[model samples]
Target: MPFPHDRPTRGSDCDCLPRPSDTKGSDAKASDPKPSDPSPSDPALPVYVLRYQDAWFGMEKRVTFAAADLDAALAITEREPIGAWAELSQDGVLLCRRGGEPGGAADYWVVD
Candidate 1:
């Protein structure tokens, strides 16, 4: 549906409003359905990408995984091949593997 800003306001002659031929309450339930609660199969667990620079030689790498906690995700990423120099973000900032090189800034999506 187009945004309200993109459409013209309804006037007295506008036929978009409810008509006598339309079934009111029958379609009302379908129009505004209640949202279901989050479940394990609902894909509620948050997903994030772990990004860091290589320790020995500077190289950027990212790993994506689903985890409940950020710490747990970091722990899982640490077990991977790049675990040695893999730096986890402390305050959701860039994870620095070496002293000088900083990870590029990019907004991560939080899966609902």
Candidate 2:
């Protein structure tokens, strides 16, 4: 007996994928949707500075980044594998702090 090499039957009539003619224009490419860099002073994401004391040497250290709020900033700090205690600041003003004990506390409180 001979084996059949015919193509498989169509599964459905619906076309889920978009066709090239449905695109915005002929000049449009898949990679053309790159977003512009956000400005440093973007209001949606305020800049924050995290200060902490090195657990091993007790030397002060700092890190800066943009976050949605103090909670987000603290979340980012918690992810870092650094000093046990850290202070989150914005515009040189202290907002909150975390881990201020010898054994390294797990909770952080607002400065106010």
RMSD of each: 12.6, 7.5
- Tens-place lDDT per residue, model 1, 8-108, is 65443445556555565465555564566433334666665667665456677876666666666656765654523454543366543422234654323
Model 1 TM-score, 2 decimals: 0.34
Residues 1-112, candidate 2: write the lDDT tens digits: 5223243324433345555555757765766644555545667788999888876788888888898777777778876645667788899888877665556555555584
Number of the top candidate by TM-score? 2
What lDDT would each prediction earn against the true structure? 0.53, 0.70
